[model samples]
Target: MTETTKQPIRVALVDDYDVVLTGLAHMFDRYRDRIVICEIDANAELSDQVDIVLYDSFAQPESDRQELAALVRNPRASRVVVYTWNFQPELVESARTQGTHGYLSKTLPARELVAALEAVHAGERVVSEPPSKRVGSAPGLDWPGRHEGFTERESEILALITQGKSNAEVAALTYLSVNTIKSYIREIYRRIGAASRTQAVLWGVAHGFSPDHHRIDHWLGGP
Candidate 1:
């Protein structure tokens, strides 16, 4: 749906690391008109705070069933989603049994992530795309220095630029306007000390921001 026609979904993000919360908040910035991030906390009292609670397990991917259950029990939020890098089928099933409304992959771009959260808020169960249904490997932008100064959106755009994608292609991938892509690129170049796209690509490759080898299991699911 177009942003103009959609209702803004109230969301609360729960993650242990401050950096993760900050990055997620920044990543969702563009969707402020459609997705309102009402809270960012490690242990927030979500009762009555949001329509959906996104529980991101940045460090430990597995063994969060009890935590998920607790979040589900909270009366503040109507739904809960486990947003993580690990989407093993067993883990997904375990989270479902624990009453999580959704299980999402970390590899999902900002648009898809927002869509999944909206679906959960609508009283639907959402799961990450299984490995076999997925197409060819997407750029694995999860590299070192990700926690550095660059925002999550900047890192994602840089990853696409390093892949030699033009601004239009990057816009399409990110579901953003071309003008927005250009603006972001300008800022990214300034931050990374690059005078041109070639220089940006070089900087990204040198600093380990380039996509790494794709593992079959990784394609199956997870961040």
Candidate 2:
């Protein structure tokens, strides 16, 4: 929702890569009225007042966790969206479980990233549905041809994980309990043998399945 010259949402970007930060800055520049983007490439001091935190996994692992913990501690966070370059399902899952706002790919299109920010700000979980498979583990695991084993709902969850959507978001979108979504996703991993998000996305791509927002809307049944 764009307003004509409205005040921007205060935002912070924490990442180790300058290129990623710059790209994000440029993206937000267009939404300058919607996102202020106060801090770029920050290592710490994730404020409570900001609308959201666009953080990198490598830049501040512990610190990022601490920031998340703090946000939940108050139970009144503005919002926190992670823009991760190195994908890991466990880490992303952990962040989702920990109450971070959303997760997205660092390499995702600026439009997608912006959409994620707006979604998170609106308090919606925004993740891209990648694909579904038998599920596998290890960063090195090669994808199999049969991802058809995962259920329609389970596949929907996997797609979100691949796109960096939080479990909470899955719950809302699917109208399932947070714990239920978590359980399904864990099962997807076990079935696919994937230990992380990057591997999952790669596997989804290798397999015939590809995540699309429409897939979730069309298949991940909800009210």
Candidate 3:
């Protein structure tokens, strides 16, 4: 398709890790003629910045429903899509309810990824079928936190920390105080044998602690 006739979809990537962002940038580089990545950001808000915001959840199993809702509710963002590995049935439905235009698996090749983005830009709600089974054991590995005696609260904190949130940001998102967030991080580090945030993030990524099993009420404080 001619560049004039086929306009590349403008995409903005949202991921906490620099590596993910950089990798995605390179992956999509070949499709520059079809898709243009306008920006890469960790912040949740972008006022009409681009045609689509792709939220990557490689390390995050639980889709942050609140963040998805906010992006959909904002008139500025034209479209929002969750690029994730977590396709729990309920999570997919919850994301749709919150205005996500698409839910795609990370396993999709770059060409399919581009097609999905194009479909979303065309105003379709796209949810790719999950693989009949997880490709390999590598994707489903979970940290033995429960067996390690970690509490539900600790699990939630670890999830957010892995997503690269600061103590203040985690406190704001979870409706807890900064000091409380710090204390939880300390205890989590001690239990998990992590000496720093980087170590904790790496552990979380490895063991799938990035996706906490949180009810909406747990983070949103609803009845």
Candidate 4:
């Protein structure tokens, strides 16, 4: 329970196995006053009784992930937390794009879970730190910032494409319309003399896109 005296935050707990769910439920029962675990159900629809959801790994089939994404898209679906032992960088990256509020490994301590939940409810992403650096932080993609190559916007959009983000997702991240992203992508292709995303990516790799590389144009100076 939160000693801070805020209204109790509703949470839903889900696990297919009764033992796991009961143990977690009992643990959360101690904090019911501040972080109420409203319902403990196995394989049940979780839309009611909670503002946030803590899902287990058994809930990770493709259909289930889509369901979770839908939950995150709800008007009240503000916080979607996945508490699973099976954490993958690829899955975490994908889930982040889907708007999950947090992704925690199940083996974390009780206090860590509470802190994660608190952060999520506080309108923050709850990915564990030191955070994995798979997505952003690609310095080469800051094209505009570099007199060396692309405009900042172009570098970013191109980086996501190379990392395999869909145009729709790239649009969401950049706050650009999907067609706008397409236009930027086309512009990138034209600048690179590449006709398609694949060729552009290959051109990027040939030039430079990471810590270990730098583009040829920076040295060759626009042939």
Best by TM-score: 3
Model 1 clash pairs?
Answer: 47-76, 48-76, 85-222, 85-223
- Candidate 1 residue 141 C-alpha distance from true site, Å: 9.3
* lDDT scores of the candidates, listed in order: 0.68, 0.55, 0.68, 0.59
Give candidate 2's TM-score: 0.47
The RMSD of every model to the true structure, in order and in angstroms, is 14.8, 14.6, 11.5, 17.7
Candidate 4 per-residue lDDT, tens place, 1-223, comes to 7585587667776544343455565555445565766665555555454667776543233225566676677674457787654345566777788878888765555666777788888888887644332322221112221444675457667766765678997776565699999999888887878887789777665554421211111111111
Best by lDDT: 3
Count clashing pairs, candidate 2: 18
Relative to the unseen true structure, what is the C-alpha lDDT of residue 142 in candidate 1, on a scale of 0 to 100? 34
Tell me how many clashing residue pairs each candidate has.
4, 18, 1, 7
> What is the full ranking by lDDT, best candidate first?
3, 1, 4, 2
Q: After superposition, how far is residue 8 of candidate 2 from its true place, in Å?
A: 2.7
Per-prediction TM-score = 0.57, 0.47, 0.61, 0.51
- As a TM-score, model 1 comes out at 0.57
Q: What stretches of model 3 exceed 4 Å from their correct place? A: 1-4, 136-223
lDDT of 4 at 172: 63
Error of 2 at 151 (Å): 36
